[model samples]
Target chain A: MKFSIQKDRFAQSVQDVLKAISSRTTIPILTGIKIDVTEEGIKLTGSDSDISIESFIPQEEEGKILAEIEQPGSIVLNARFFNEIVKKLPLDRIEIEVMNSFQTVIRSGQSEFNLNGLDPEEYPHLPQIEEREVFKMPTDLLKTIIRQTVFAVSASETRPILTGVNWRMEDGRLVCIATDSHRLAMRKAAVETDSDAEYNVVIPGKSLNELSKILDDTKEPVEIVITDSQVLFRAKHLLFYSRLLEGNYPDTSRLIPTESKTKLELNTKEFLQAIDRASLLAREERNNVVKLSVIDQDTIEISSNSPEIGKVTEQVKSRSVEGDELRISFSAKYMMDALKALDGTEINVQFTGAMKPFIIRPEQDDSTLQLILPVRTY
Target chain B: MKFSIQKDRFAQSVQDVLKAISSRTTIPILTGIKIDVTEEGIKLTGSDSDISIESFIPQEEEGKILAEIEQPGSIVLNARFFNEIVKKLPLDRIEIEVMNSFQTVIRSGQSEFNLNGLDPEEYPHLPQIEEREVFKMPTDLLKTIIRQTVFAVSASETRPILTGVNWRMEDGRLVCIATDSHRLAMRKAAVETDSDAEYNVVIPGKSLNELSKILDDTKEPVEIVITDSQVLFRAKHLLFYSRLLEGNYPDTSRLIPTESKTKLELNTKEFLQAIDRASLLAREERNNVVKLSVIDQDTIEISSNSPEIGKVTEQVKSRSVEGDELRISFSAKYMMDALKALDGTEINVQFTGAMKPFIIRPEQDDSTLQLILPVRTY
Candidate 1:
């Protein structure tokens, strides 16, 4: 491959693809990034079996020439070193040339680099998924959905299916859910699709985490194509593919309590801060558990006690409190994560009892809900 | 003990002292910070055997009450948890009360914490250093000197004395030197001493690093007292004491050459960037070696070749070049460190020969100099 391209453009593309390249890959070739030059543009691909990322730089962008092709060829370079060199190159334009035996030379300004390139033919081929069920949504909305639910996914691999976020589409509405048995998060949004056929898939939480980082905050649309075993997210000049988990996701709709004997509405920031301070002492203990007890109609006490370290109690004013008095204990980390994901100034928390799971939702909307199972404390 | 202090002032004092409290210490009481409430003010001390730091919060400053002492007493609280609690407390004023059996209750606004405190009598006493020979220098200057020389200290424990920075004073001038045998950094400054006595001491590099972080960038003078076993630094409201390394420091004066066969003056930033880029490829090799050769009277080439990965060559322009043409190879990391230590826009590099150590000094002054030994490349 012989082509000259703008250094900044190439560096950005290389960085985007690098997210999928892991250093500990079992397949040696997976550690390398494949670079293919065609008549239209140049494509870079990086994969780690679980996820594959491809970024393309067109020959011309906005009437300005970004790259000029001298010959069409392909080669694989060590992703780690290649990305480092590209980022540190001290020039605007970089020229890359491939010689016999796949010896690649990169030149920019007065600096030049010659790297040993592997045969691109040994690289794994991108899985082909027929575009039968493709849906489009604003990039901002997709990013928000991923952020709101992905953190609640089970980090433990005991239940492999729970390590992914389950996505279900029905009647043009899409719902995403993630739960670790002790805590659950769900978000619902509307998407545009040509077919009314319903579908369900579980995408590894790690894939969603990486995808969210690469997604920009622009209002542009992103096309998602789902198949039985793979999924693809397509944006401008970028293609992200992730393998689908091969198990049925557990039904979580029945886990959230529909009615509660006690309800409280409080300022999100104030409640989060109180829990955060209480966690300072609770974190030293085994379970990182914090307790909340209703003091009066308008006040609640958040506290945690460690036998050896210390005990902390914080009183936060609630906007409104109703129903019976109650005290409950739960993981401070789970509560903080749930509060952070909710949008708005106020949050409504519902409790069925001290021992049962409770639900938390933004006071302004009901499209998202977080449920946490309370810990039994003597 | 009972006192109400401004939260921000108390938090800053706690943070400053906590740096000396290490969790791995064998002395159990050393993990706690000693808090002594006196009629005049409150003092907080934290120690880990090798170093001790104390910060004082005066009762009143400029007619403003920073703290009000209700009674006089002392106790020790766990440094790790106390610092975290103080930082996250949600109030402007904090009240700390030591109850029966050293149970400390800290109250701020609607929040309260009761922590287990250790007996103040069990905490190790701070070493007393007689004010026999005290010197004064600008805090900013002291911080700069430490930063410019401390990084060259040997990290390997093979020669324990090399892990410290040697401080020597003679004829009203103070010199600090640090070397790992392969590279050396030296900085000199003038200070006012109470007597014309010469002294030398080696302070651990880790202690200096922590002390430098707490020093403010002000023109106010800092008093330093040196003794046979320990050195003490006194600032406005802070006292830092560090134990001296007990060994003789090697003389490094003979290592620097008096004359050079080749002399080059170049912009410090440009030359550093070129070396940084060259190191990108060289770092993959075993030794991280980069070669520099004089191409002409006013230009030089910086390059690195990794037989398995690639080769990179960069040509950087020089302001002036004199003496014989030479090519030398050295550790890119050492060269980068030496270049970063220089303080001016331009730097003067002097090389005795291809195989001898080179000296790099700021073009504007001789207050600081860095010496790097070249690697013998085959």
Candidate 2:
């Protein structure tokens, strides 16, 4: 491969692909990034078995030439060193050439680097997914959906399927759900689909987390293609593929209570800050549990007591409280996570008695919901 | 302590004293910060044996009352938890009261915390240093001197004295030197002393590092009092005490080269960047050795070669070359460290021979000098 490309453009593409590269991969070839220079553009690919990313830099962009290719070829370069060299090079343009024995030479200004390249043929090929069922959504929307649900996914591998977020199509809306057995987060959004076909797939939460980072916050559309065992996301010049979990996801719809014994509406920021302070003392304890008790009709008391370290009590004013009086205890971390994901000035919390699961939702929008199972502190 | 203080001021003072609290200390009370509320003001102290910091918040500063004392008492609270509580409290003014059984109640707005406070009598007392000889310098200058020399100190504990920076008063100038035997950095500055007394002491590099962090970059003078076993730094309302390293520092004056076989003047930034790029490849090797060879009267080539990963070569323009044509190899990290310490647009590097030590100094200032030993590359 012989080509000269704009240094900044190449650096960005390399960074995007690096998200899929894992230094601890069992496969040796997977540790390197595959670079292919073709007539169309330059493609850089990185994979770590579970996810694969390919970022393409076009030869010409917006009537301006970004790359000039003299020969068409492919090679695999160590991702770690290649990335460092590209980021630190002091020049506007970079020239890369592959010679005999896969010797790659990179030059920019008065600096030149010679790296040992491997045969690109040894790298695994990306999974092929038939585009029979595809959905499109704005990049920012997809990012928001991922952020709202991914954090609730089970980090422990005891139940492998629970480590992924379940995506399903119900009617015309797409719903994403994740739960760690203690708490659950769900988000629903409207998507453009080619058919009325319903689909359900469990994608590893880690994959979604990485995808969210690479997705730009622009209004541009991202096309998603789903198959039996794989899913592909294509956006402008980037393609991301992730493997689907091979087990059934637990049905979590029934876990969220539909009825409420008590309801309270309060400012989101104030409630979040109250729980954050309560968590400071609770964190010293193993369970990180904090208690919330309704006082009178318009105030809520949040407190956490550590037998050895002492206790903290905070009173937060609520806009309105209705139904039965209640006191509930739950993980401060879980409540904080749920509160942060709901983007609203005010939040409505519904408690179905103290022992049962409680639900939290944005007072303005009902598309996002969070549920937490209270711990029996008594 | 029973008092109400401004939250921001209390938080800042708590953070400053926290630098002296080490979680890994053997003494349990050392992990806690002592709070003393006297009629005059409130004082916070944290110590980790090697270093101790005391920050005082007076009742009134410049006619503004920062704290109101309701009761006079002393207690020690866990630094980790106290800092977190102080930082997250939701109020402008904080009220702290010591109740029966040493149960301290901290209140701010509607938030309250009850912490288990230890008896202040159990906490170790700060070392007392006699005010025999004292030197004064701008806090910013002291911070600058520490930064310029601390990085060269030996990180290994094999040579205890080498792990500390040697401070000596020579010919009315305060000189600081640090060396790991491989490289050395020395900085000198004039200071106002009460007497023309000659003093020599080795202060632990780690203590100096923390001291630099707490010292504000202002024109306020920091009074440094030196004793036989301890050094006390007093600035405004803050007092910092550090135990001196007990050992005889080796004489490093003979290590500096007096004559030079070759001399080169180059832009400091360009030379630093060239070495930085060369180090990328050198890092792959065990020794991290980079070679610099003068190509002609005004050009030098910096290069590093890893047999398995290939090599990198960079050509940097020099302002002037004198004495002789030479090629030498050295640790890229040490060279980068020395280059970063010198504050100048251009630097003058004097090489004694291919295998001997070389000196690097700023072209415009004689206050600081760096000497590096060359690595013999066969």
Candidate 3:
């Protein structure tokens, strides 16, 4: 392929595709980024078997000639070294041309780089799925759905299915849930989709995180296509595909508490600060457990103790409390994560008992909820 | 000990002393910070054997009560955890009191921390240095002196003295030199010092780097005290002590050439950028060598070629070049370091021959110089 493209446009497209580049050298061809030039634009593709990212750079943008194609062909180049050279090239525009043997030549300003390129036929092809089960959602909503639940997924590979976030659609509402068995996060939103379509899929949390990073924060709509095993998200000039995790996701509906005996409404900021200070001491302990004690009708105490290090106690006032005097211990990290996922100024936490799991939800909205199992502290 | 101190003041002092705390558990006592309180104020000290730092919180400052000592005593606390606790505490003023048997209670706002403290008598005492051989220099100058030469020190400990920066005082001028055998950096400055007492001492590059970080970017003077085996720097309420490296440093005077066969002057920024681009291709090679060829009086070519990674060629313009057509190869990293150390916009590079070492200095002033040995490339 012979082409000349502007440096910045090419750099951005390369970066988008590089998100899927395989860092492992076990599969030699997978470590390369495949480039194809056509009359319309240049397409860049990178895949690591689990996820694939494809970005296209158009020929013209804002009356500037971004790329001029002489011949349409394909070649795969090393992703890392190619990206570094393109970033450091000291010119506004770059010229790239490939020889008959797939030797690539990149020229900018007074600097020129010639690299050995591999045949595009050696690279793995991306599976193409028919766009029958497709839906549209706002980019911001999709990113939020991914961020709120991805962190709760089990990072350990013991239960491969638990390492993925479960997504289910019913009655035009999309629900995303993830749990590592210790804590759980759930978010629900109304995505624009056909009423007849009902879908359930589990995508690896690590892939979702990478996809979220590549998603731009814009008001544009993102089109998602789901197959039997692969899901694709297309936004602007970028296409992201992730493989679905196998096996059934455990029923999380029964994990959330339906009722509580004690409830407290507190300002999220004040509660977060109190927990942060209490966590300072708890983090020194092995289990990172902090206790919460509710007293009278207006005061809540957060405390943590480590026998070898120290103990810290903090008092935080609540907006309203209608609960029996109680003391409960739970993972400080879990409480901090649940608080961060919430966006409301005031949050309501419901407690069943010292041993039973507790629920945290926004005071004004119940669409999002977090549940944490309290640790038994003797 | 009992005292109340402003949170900001206490936090700053704690941070300063925490720098000396060792993260390694090899020296258990070095992991803790020693605290001493008297009628005057409170002193915090942290030592890791190689370096010691002490920061004092005065009884009053700017007509405001920074600290009030109710009783005089001493104790030691774990530095890392204590610094984190103090930084996260939610109060403008904090009160700390020592209970029976070294238990310390730290209270601020509605939060309280009860930390286990160690008896201060077990902490190592800092060696007292006589102030007879002393001098003073602005903190900024001292920091600059350290930065310009520290990078050239040999990181390998094969030759102990090569890992340190050689500092010498002669004829009221302080000269600092660091060489890793491949490259050398020398900087000299006139400072007010004891003319009768000419001194030579080698300090470890790591210690100088830490000292430079602790010095503020103000014009305040820092007192320097030199002893038989240690050096002390006092600035404001902070005291920094570093152990001197023992051993005879190699004589580097004969390594620098006094005469040159060719000279070239170019803009430092442009030359550095050209070398940076050229190095991108050479980075994959074993030695990362970039070659410079002076073809004429106005233009110079910088190039690097790797058998597997291709070649890069960049042409840089020069203000003046009166050299014989010469081609020399050297490490891109060493050249970049020399360019970064140049204090002037234009730099003059003097080349003695193809294989001899070259000198790089500012065109206006030559007090500071950098030398790089050319690689023998067949």
Candidate 4:
């Protein structure tokens, strides 16, 4: 197979697929990216067992020549070295040739690189998923939802299912939830989908993170297809597939309290800074715990103490406070994550009691919420 | 100690001193920063045996109130936590007060931090250097010299002296030389010093790197004071002292050949990029070796090969090539470091033979030189 393509265009496509190439050497062939030349265009695929990413470069794009195939063939080359070579090639155009012996030669400007290539047949095939349950959503909204909730997923492998984010669709809305038993984050948005179709798939949080990075910030709509086990998201020339966890996600609705005894509204940035400062002292303690106490109608106290490192206390003013005054202590890292996920300027935090889990949400909206279980401190 | 200092001034000083505090907590007191308050000013010091950094905030500067001290005393506090607290304090001015039993209270805005402090007597005292041998040079020049040569220092602890840079003065010319036995980097500049007094010292490379970072890029000159075994640099309100390594630094002059049979001049940036690209293919190999061969008076070939990973060959147009054609291989990392040290449009490389050591210098200036030994490739 022989082809010539613009250096910049090829480099970007290579980079997108290279992200999925396996870094683990258990499967030696998986370390390489498979490239296929077809009559329509060129397709590149990279995959580990958990996730796979594929990108296509059409023969012509916007009346500009992208690639021309002399013969339809396939080959696999080391993903990392190939990407580096393409990026550093000093020319506007790049020429690639694959010999009968699976030897690949890449040339640009005055430089030529000859790399040992493996037969594409030796590479694993992309999972076959039917598009019968296809749905569409804006890329920007999906990226935001992923970022807002992915951070709360459990990093430990004790409960494998908790390591994945739960995505469910009902009515005409899409909901994403992630929880590590300690803290939970949830986001919901409207999307155009089959009214009769519903999805309750759990995708690994790490895989979702990698997918979010590859998704460009564009207004273009992404087509998502779900099969019995795997999920596929397609946007423009890129195709992303993630393996779903085969287990039932925990019922998280019961974990979120339905009632509250006290509620306070404060600017998100102000509360974040206060907690950040309080965290300085708390970080020296064993659990990295910081305490928040509602002193009066308009005053809130944030404090942390370590026997050896001393203590810090800060007073932050709030717009309003009601119900019984309460004090709660929780991990500073968890609080920071919950605050970062919040988008609005003001946030409403509700407390059931000093020991019960409290919920935080945008002051004006209830579509997104974060819940943190306080730690008991003497 | 009781004082009020501008938050910005205190924060910057804390950060400067924090650089000298090592993360290893073998010495508990060494992990703490010493703060001394006087009617004249406030001085903060951090030390880890090998190096010490002290930054002072005067009571007043240019009619502005930098620090106001009501009591004169000193205390030591955990440097890491203290720096973080000062940086995040939410006030323009910070008030610090020391109470009985070594308790320190720092207040800013509506936030207050009560920190446990250690007795200042437990802190190591800064060595007093005689004022006999002193010189001054621009902070920028000192940073430049350190940056240009520090990368060549040996990182291994086997040959401890090679981990330091040999600094010497001859005929009012200050020269800094560093070599790990495989490669050498030298930087020379003229400084104001006593013509009759010549000095030589080996300063630890790691210490020099930290000193370079702390040196602000200003026109102000830094005073250099040499003690029997310690070198101190005073700049503005900051005092930095580093213990010199004992024993003799190897004579590197003999390693740098004075004559050559072949020489080539090439664009610095272009050569660096070519070497960077060639290294990609050689990275899989143990040595990361890249070969350079003079093809003619105006051309040179750069190439690398691995039996399993294939090969890369690139021809770079040389500005001028003289003498006999030659081919030599060396570590790509070494060549890149040399090229980075010499900031010039064109760099001249001299090669005595294919197996001998070579020297690289810029065509416009002779203040800096880099040398590398060839690797015998089968």
Candidate 5:
């Protein structure tokens, strides 16, 4: 294989694929990145068996020549060393050539690096899925959905199903939900699809987090194809694949409280700041709990106490507070996360009682909701 | 103690003192910060036995009022909690008052915190040094001198003395040197001192690092006083004290080689970049060794090799190479650090032999010098 390419564009593509490569993979060859050169262009593939990422570089882009190919072949090189060398090459253009016995030489201005390459034939093939029903959504909207719900997923491995976000798409409407039993986040949006097929798949939260980083904040449409065991997200020049978790997600619709004995409307920024300050003391406790007391329509007081350290109390003014007065305690971290994800200046909070689950929503927005189960305090 | 102070200034002072306080101290009281209130102003102090820092806020500075003292008293509060609370107070002005049983109340806009305070009497007293003769230097210059020499100190405690920088003062000139037995960095400067007391002392590298962080970049003069066991650095509103290491520093004047077998002049940046690229492959070796081979009166080639991994070679043009051709190997990290510390555009390198130590100096400057030993590579 012999090719010369523009240095900056090639470096970016190399880094994007490297995010999926893992040093601790069970298969040793999976730790390397495979480069395939064809008559059309060059494709770079990286995989750790669970997640695979592929990025392509066209021979010419926008009437500008990016690469000149002398031969068509394939080679696999160490992902770590390849990235480090590519980024530090002294010139704007670099050349790579493969010799006998898979010895690869990379040359830039006056610098050269020779790396031991692996046989590409030993690499595993990426899963190929027939595009039966590909759905599309704006790149920015997909990133928002991923950020809103992924943080609520369970980090523990005991209940592996809860470690992923459940996606259900039907009738052009898609709903995504993630819950760790104590707290839950749900977001709903509309997608563009031509087929009538529906998808109810669970995507690992780790995969969504990495996907969010790769997606840009543009209105470009991303086509998603889902199968029984594999899912693919296709962007302009990149392809991301993730394995589906094989388990039934728990039903969370019944867990959200429908009735409210106490209702309040407050500024999200004010509430979040109060909770952050109160948590400073609460952080000394094992549960990291803070208490909130509503004094009718007068004020809302947030407080935390530690036996040895001390206590803190702060009062925040709210837009309105109705129904019976109440006091409740919950994890400060959970409340802050809910407020931040809601991303609204004004939020409406509803509580059935101190012990039951509470739901929070952005004012006048019914498509997003957050639920938290308050902790019992004596 | 009762006082209302400007929140921003108070918060900055708290952070500065907290740098000296450690949570894992052997003495329990050392974990708390002592606040002393007097008729003039308020003083905040933190100490970890080896180092102590104190910041004072006068009642008024210039024509602006910074604090309002209601009474004169003293108390010690947990350094960690004090800093966190002060930084997040809701108002621009915060009031701190001590009530019965040493219970301190901190109040801002509508927020209040009650903290358990310790008796100031139990806190260890700071070392007091009588100033017989004090030396003055530009604050910015002192910071620069500290940065140039501190990184060369030994991180290992095997030879405890090597972990500190030796400061020798005589005839109004001060010289500092640091080495870890492999590489050495030396810096010298002139100070304004009237006393003829020739002095030599070793200051802990950790102390200088912390002191550098607390100082700001300015041309204002800083007063430094050294005694038998302690050194004090006094600024406008801050006082920093550090304990001196007790040992005799070995004489190193004879270790420098005067005769040279090869000499080369090169651009500091170009040579540094070449070595950085070569180090990418050399980093896999146990010693991180990179080789430099000079072609007489021609370009210099830098290279590194690993048996398992490949190799790299880069050629950098030098201004003049008047010495005999030679090939030598040394640690790339030491060379990079020395180059960065020199901060010069053009540098002159002198090599005595393949086995002897070599010295690097900024062109036409004699106040700063770096020396490194070559490693034997078969």
Candidate 6:
């Protein structure tokens, strides 16, 4: 391949593809990025078996020639070294050319790098997924959905299926849910699509996180295609593909509590800060548990104790509280994470009992919900 | 002890003292910060045996009441927990009170903490230094001197004395030197003293780093006192004590070459960037070595080759180059560090030969010098 491209735009494309490359992969070529040059543009591909990312840089855009193609060819270069050299090149235009025996030359300003490139034919081909149905959603809304639920996925590999977030689309809405057995986070959004196809697939939480970082936060629409074993997200100049989890996701609809004996409304920021302070001591313990005690109809107390260190108690006033006086202990980290992911100031929390899971949601919206199981501390 | 202090100011003071407190100390009591309350103010002290820091919060400053002292007493609380609690308290004013049986109550807004405080009587006393002589210099200058030399100190403990920076004062100027056997950094400054005292001492590089972080960047003067076994730095409302290294420092004056075969002047930034780019490949090697070869009177080439990976060559233009043609190899990291610490853009480099040490300094300044030993490439 012989072409000169704008330094900044090419570096960005390289970075996007690099997100999918892993140096520890068993396939040596998988650790490198494949470059294909054609009449249209230059395409960069990187994969680590689980996820594959492809970013394209066109020859010209908006009346400006971003790249000049001298020949159409392909080569695979080490991703780590290519990225480092491209980022530190001393000029705005970078020229990369392939020679006999696959030796690649990269020149920019006064700097020149000669790298031993591998044959692009040795790289494994990406999974083939015929697009039968496509769903379109706003990029910002998709990012929000991932942010709200992905953190609840189990980080352990004991049950590999729980490390993914289940995306269920039916009728005219999409629901994303993630649970780690101890807690659950669910977010609902109204999505627009031209088909009646429904998807109940689970995408790895790690993949969703990487996709979120690469997607721009704008109202621009992104095309999503789901197949039997793979899902692809298509943006303006990028294609992201992630493998779906093999096993079925556990049904979590019955896990959410339907009714509560105690209910309270509190300011989210104030309550989060109170739990944060309470966790300062509780964090020393294994579970990082904090207790909540209902003192009266209008006030409650949050406290944590570590015998060797100290004990902290904080009183937070609720807009309104009603029910039997109760005391419950739960993971302070889970509560703080849930609160931070929420968007509103006021939140309503409902408890079934001291031992049962409690549900928290925005006061005026029922779309986003968080549930945490109480720890047995009595 | 009972007092209410402004949260922000108190938190800043607590942070400063916590720098000296390490959880890995030999003495258990050293992990706790001692608090002493007097009619005038409140003092917080933290120590790790090698270094101790005391920060005071006065009752009033600039006609504003910062702290209101109701009782005078002393107590020591776990530094880790105290700092965490003070940082997250939800009010402008925080009240700390010592109750019976060494129990302390810290209250802010609606939050209260009950901590198990240790007896202050067991806290070790700071080293007492007689007020024989004191030298003063701008806090910014002190910070600069530490920044220029500390990174060159040997991190290995084999030669324990090399882990400290030697400071020698004679005439009206103070010189600081640090080396790791391969390279050396020296900085000199004119300082004013209240008494006629010429001294030479070695202060632990770690302590200077900590002191630099605690001192503000303003040009306000800071008082420095050197004793037989300890050095004391007194800033407004703060006292920092550091124990000196316990061995004689080796003289490094003769290591710097006085005569050179080749001399060159170059733009500091251009050469540094070239070296940085060249090091991208060299960094994979054991010594991170990069080579510089003079191409002509006004041009030079910086290059690095890794047989298995690749090679990079960059040509950089120099302002002037004279004397014998030469080629030398050195650690890219050391060269980068020296260039970053320099003040001006134009720098003069004097090379003795391909194997001997080279000297680098600002174009017109002789107060700061850097000597780097070259590696044998053939």
Which candidate number maximizes DockQ?
Answer: 6
The residue ranges of model 4 lying beyond 4 angstroms of the native Cα positions read none
Q: Write the per-residue lDDT of candidate 6 for residues A14-59, one digit (tens) a residue.
A: 9999999988888899989999999788999999989999999889
TM-score of each: 0.98, 0.99, 0.97, 0.98, 0.99, 0.99
The TM-score of candidate 6's chain A against the true chain A comes to 0.99
Model 6, runs deviating above 4 Å: none
lDDT of 3 by residue, B1-378 (tens): 888888888898889888777798597778898999998899999999889999988898778778878888888988888898889888888988989888999999999999999888899999788758778889998888888899999999989899999989888788899999999999998877754578899988988988888889988998888877998999999999999999888999999999988899999999999898888878866478999999788999999988776777888899989857789999999999989977889999999998999999998886899999999998
Task: Show where candidate 5 strays beyond 4 Å.
Answer: none
Alpha carbon deviation, residue B322, candidate 4 (Å)? 1.8
Taking chain A by itself, what TM-score does each prediction score? Answer: 0.99, 0.99, 0.98, 0.98, 0.99, 0.99
> Could you give candidate 2's per-residue lDDT for residues A66-117 as a string of tens digits?
9999999999998988999999998999999999999999999999999999
TM-score for the first chain in candidate 1 comes to 0.99
- State which docking tier applies to candidate 6: high
Give the Å shift of residue B234 in candidate 3.
1.6
**Model 3: TM-score, first chain:** 0.98
User: For all the predictions, what are the DockQ values?
Assistant: 0.83, 0.89, 0.76, 0.88, 0.82, 0.91
**Which residue pairs overlap in candidate 6's backbone?**
none
Give lDDT tens digits, candidate 4, residues A68-186. 77788889999989999999999888889997589999999889999999988899888998659678888998898998899999999999999999999888778899999999999
DockQ winner between candidates 1 and 3: 1
Tens digits of per-residue lDDT for model 1, B157-266: 99999999999998999999999999999999999886998989999999999999999999899999999999999999999999999999999999989999999999
The lDDT of each candidate is: 0.94, 0.93, 0.89, 0.91, 0.92, 0.93
Residue A149 in model 2: lDDT: 98
Report the C-alpha displacement of residue A79, candidate 4, in angstroms: 0.5
Over the stretch A180-246, how does candidate 1's per-residue lDDT look in tens digits?
9999999999999998978899999999999998889989999999999999999999999999999
Which of the predicted structures, 1 or 5, would earn the higher lDDT when compared with the native? 1
TM-score of chain B of 3: 0.98
